[model samples]
Target: MQTTFTPAQLENPHTAHSEQIIRKCVHCGFCTATCPTYVTLGNELDSPRGRIYLIKEMLENDRPADAKTVTHIDRCLSCLACMTTCPSGVNYMHLVDHARAHIARTYRRPFMDRMIRQVLAMTLPYPARFRASLTMARLGRPLAPLFAAIKPLKPFAAMLRLAPSHVPAKAAINDPAVHAAEGPRQKRVALLTGCAQSVLDPKINEATVRLLNRLGVEVVVPKGEGCCGALVHHMGQEDEALGFARRNVDAWMRVADEDGLDAILITASGCGTTIKDYGHMLRLDPAYAEKAAKVSALARDVTEFLAELELPLPVNKTDLLVAYHSACSMQHGQKITRAPKVLLAQAGFTVRDVPEGHLCCGSAGTYNILQPEIAATLRDRKVRNIESTAPQAIATGNIGCMTQIGSATQIPILHTVELLDWAFGGEKPASLAGVEPRVEPALAAAE
Candidate 1:
């Protein structure tokens, strides 16, 4: 893991930071076992250890990203399972992120690849554009198989397949407004009504707002707070990503300064991970650096925030078995392993853990759309493990995981908060209809 960056090369902030991360790697290769790409593709270059070497070579030589390096890095899911598996505490997430930014700066992709990446960057982070694109996708969805036959058109095919048939009307909860607590307001926080999640499934936000309000927490959907930049950030669009971070910082800081906020809650774990890292992401900005750090301190996943509350007994307890599919961002990126499951259990569902839980479901932001073949492989594997648990429904904290897994399985996939909200007297999820709850005699007697 010894690096040969010149003192001049080390002078660059990014290179210096990556150097620190690279130095921490002891070349143990423990990451290979857990890396989804390495596990599936069996390519050494596809693993964390392999990519570290490629990154080091590219940086040390101060050359543009070669095809080989770009290919391996592009295949990476950035699941951060390697970070969890590494005994050396290598910050693979930051290192990989730095590598991606470098690739964005130097690598020039093919014509189709460039167009697809550009289209994603332009649309996916904007709600109106994404919604419109979905409308158009329905037309192209019929052509997915035709697109799949051509090599360059595969991403479009993947996108068409993943687009939902029915785009629900935008939820009122996403409007830049406030929902007061149902009772005495104990806390107030801003909710990140994210870009894709808002457009894709506003019900998740609706469920979140309802549950938090019922629990006596005031939720604000702040104006000017748009995407968390995670969608483009992973694509190596550094400037665009940082622009998103700064705008969100301004929006959240305005709320914090004027109305005061107990926390900045995020229902999407992917956004939660990026939002929590605003401190590091904006560390070099003179004006935003301190404010960004403060905001990061206040950022919390909805489950992380809810776990601290004194949850009441479920208003309607049932012996519902839930196979909890921990999103990669939740378990590995943010290291939030227990809160969601603990919350589900307290809400009276029998929470079952999925086997091979540490692996990614291949929904690492835009990874699925960009790398459809490998994404399908990992998704199928994840679905198999999840189905083996024999649960009445699948519960996850991420909209991406819900979509990716739901498309391939019959089990009703729902956000964890939705299930919690339903258990605590809100309306039951429509997807859960006809899903009979098992009766546990001892638990029924206790109830």
Candidate 2:
């Protein structure tokens, strides 16, 4: 794993980090067993160790990434399951991130690839635009066959089929101005109304707010808080991601100063993991470095916060078989291993672990859309694993996992917060009640 960096490469920030990460690896291939792409493709190039070598070579030589390297790196889900399996503690997340940024800057993607990436980066983070796009997608679903003449249109059709037929009902947006609730405020937190979550399923945030309020925590959804930049960051759009990060940091800081803040709660695991790393991501930014660090320190996943609160358990115990789908970011990125399951079990639900739970369900942000073939394979595998458990319901933290797993399985896939909210005297999710008419296989399984 020794790196031979040229003089020019030594000056590159990314190469330096790659060199540091490379030295930590003892050439152990244990990570290969857990990597989803490697496990499915059975190609060394798709494995973490193989990708690390490619990244090391591309960076050390100070040359533009070639098509082969780009293909292998792009296939990665960034699930960080390798990190969990590696005994050496190699930081694959940072290494893969650096590789992605390098690829975006130096590699020239196909015209169609560029167009799709651009559309996702621009629309996914904006709620209004995303909502409009979903409506259009629904309308276009029927016309999918018309576009079948074009090869690229096939995946678009698949993506459209996966889109929820109807947007979940909107939840009450918490007003930051109103600080006090009827009960004594035990703690105050600014809940991140995520970009995709806001558009795809606003009810997730509603459930989050309801659960927090019930626990006597004053939940504040601050204005001007846009995307957490996770979408762009994963695409190697560092500038755009950092811009969103700075805006969020400033907005939350203002709220913290106005009304004493305890922590920033995020229901989405991907956003939570990235926000928690804002400290390191913005360490070099002169203007907002210190402020970004402060904000990052305050970020916490909803389950993490709830675990610490030790809230009272609900009186009624429902005998339901719950298969807990541990998100890659929650378990491997944040290292939040047991909080969600413990909370569910405490609430009187029988929580069972899905087989191959560490493997990514192929919903790595927009990965399912971009790499449809491999994503489908992984999704099918995950679906099979869940079926083996024969659980009445599937519970997951991140929305991407929920939707991806939902697309593959017939069982009702729900956010952990939604299940907790329902168990605590709230109504069941419509998807679970079989009230919503949809073609999603997961919805049918719920019935």
Candidate 3:
């Protein structure tokens, strides 16, 4: 894996990073065994080795990527399972990210595909826009069959089917600033108000706040913090992603300056993974680079921080079987392998591993909406594995995995923080009661 980069190409930061990653690979096929696409499709082009070759050629040639390369790259879930399997220490996450950004810049997709990607990039990262879209999806759910009749709109229709009917009305605040019921607090953390998570399940954030406060960490939901840009980044909208990153960095930095923040906790694994990489993502930016690095250092997954604190466990132990679906970002991307399960066990739940836990649930940010066929296949596979575990409830760190798995399985899907919250004295999730909540009636139809 040698690169002969031109002087001009080396001048570009992304190209230089891509070149370094290319040189690290020795064409070892070990990563293919754990790659979800290769495992499912049995196509070499879908494997890490194949993708590396594709990316190499695409970058080396400095030409717009052809449809074949775009197809193979698009098929990737960006789960980063390959990184865990690779003995060569190849940075597949960064490499694939560079490839995605290249594709978004150079590739001209078909009309329908472009439309879907555009809609997702425009809506998913904005809470207000996503909320409005969900309402429209609910009203339009009855006409799903009609929408499905059109080839271009079928994916949209399927995505609509997955939408929850009633999202929590607003973000929840559970710290001393908002909730006085919680006694003395030791640390004050600002919770990231994720774009999709806020609209889809504000309860997850509510659970996060409660769990943190119970652990003596006062949670703060800063007024201006918005999407973590994870969705747009995966879609290869780097500018939009970085813009969101800078805004968050500034907002959190302001909060830190004012109140002396301890850490920024993120409940969603995908967002957590991205926010932690802000230092690298903005390393080249002149103005916000230093600020981004500082903010990135302060970001932590809820479980990661809680595990470090050695928080007091709940005395009441419920004999509930739990299937832990480790989000790809948490396990592979962030290299946080066991914190969530260990936290669950300490909270007194029987945690079981879902088979093929390394595979993505097809909710790779905007992946489900943009690539429905492949996404549906992967989601079905994840659902089947979860069913095999025979667990009373399913717990995961990322909101995307929760929703994706929830759509495919009958068992209630709870955020890892939610279970932690419940164990510490919050109410049990309604879905675990053997009856799914009727608010998302469309989900009932999905079952």
Candidate 4:
């Protein structure tokens, strides 16, 4: 794991950080055991250790990224599961991010690849455009089978296949306004009305606001806030990603300065991870550096924030057994393990953990759309593990996980806050419409 960076290379901050990360590797290959691609394909290059060597050599040589390195790197889900498995504490996230940024700058992708990546970058971060694309994708969905026959068009086919049949109406919660607490405002926080999540399922944010208000927490959807940049950041669009970050920092920091923020609450764990890392990502910017650090300091996942709250007893407790799918970002990236599951259990649902919970569901932002074949493999594997536990439904934190897993399995999937909100006397989730909540035996005995 010894690095061979020159003095000139060491001058680059990214190179220096990656070199430190590379040197931390003991070549233990513990990461291979947890890596979804390696577990599925059994390729050494697909594993974190293998990729680390590729990244180290690529960085040390200071050469343009070749197809071999790009292939292995592209296949990576970036789930950060390897980070969790590594006993040496390698920051694979930062290292891989640096590698991706380098690839985007140096490696010229194939025409189709470039076109698709460009399309995703331009479309996904904007809600209106994304919704329009989804509507168009509905028409294209009928051609998915035809597209799948063509090798290059397969990703487009996956996109067509995955587009929701019906998009939800945009909610009032998405507006830049405040929902005050029912009685007294103990805390005021800004909610990230995320790009994709707002477009895909508006109820998740609505539920979060309702639940937060019930807990005496004022929730504000900051006016200028947009995408978390995670969708493009992992794609190696460094400038675009950083631009989104700066805009968000300005928006949220303005809100913080005027209204006061106890926490910048994030419902999407994937977005939460990136939002929480705003400090490290923007450290070099003299103007934004301090503000970004402050923003990251204030950031918290909804579950993380809620776990600290004195939640009311569930007014209408359900006895449904929930298979809690811990997202890779939530567990490894943010190190939030128990909050969601514990919250579900406290809300009177029997929460069950999926087997092989450390593995990725292959929904690492745009990973599923960009690499459909490998993504399908890992997703099927994840679906099998989730099904191994008998549960009435599935509860996950991120919308990406819901989209990926729900497409593969029959079990209804919902964002954790939706269920929590329902349990605390709000409307029941649509997924549980007909499924009756189990009656307790103690109550039956009394009857």
Clashes of each: 0, 1, 0, 0
Off by over 4 Å in 2: 143-151, 169-171, 174-179, 434-447
Candidate 2, residues 36-58: lDDT per residue as tens digits? Answer: 99999999999999999999888
Per-residue error (Å), model 1, residue 182: 1.7
lDDT of 3 by residue, 35-76 (tens): 888988999999999999999999988989899999999889
Model 4's alpha-carbon lDDT is: 0.93
As for candidate 1, its clashing pairs are none
lDDT tens digits by residue: candidate 4, 1-447: 887799999999999999999999999999999999999899999999999999998999999999999999999998999999899999999999999999999999999899999999999999999999999999889899998999888889989988998999877789899899989889999999999999999999999999889888998888999999998999999999999999999999999999689999888999999999999999999999999999999999999999999888999968898999999999999999999999999999999999999988888899998899988888898899989997889999999999999999999999999999999989998878987766678988999
Candidates 2 and 4, the one with greater TM-score: 4
lDDT of 1 at 17: 96
Residue range 270-376, candidate 1, lDDT tens digits = 99999999999999999999999999999999999999899888997556999999999999989999999998998889999999999898888898999999999
TM-score of each: 0.98, 0.93, 0.93, 0.98
Candidate 1 Cα lDDT to native: 0.93
Q: For model 3, what is the C-alpha lDDT against the true structure?
A: 0.85
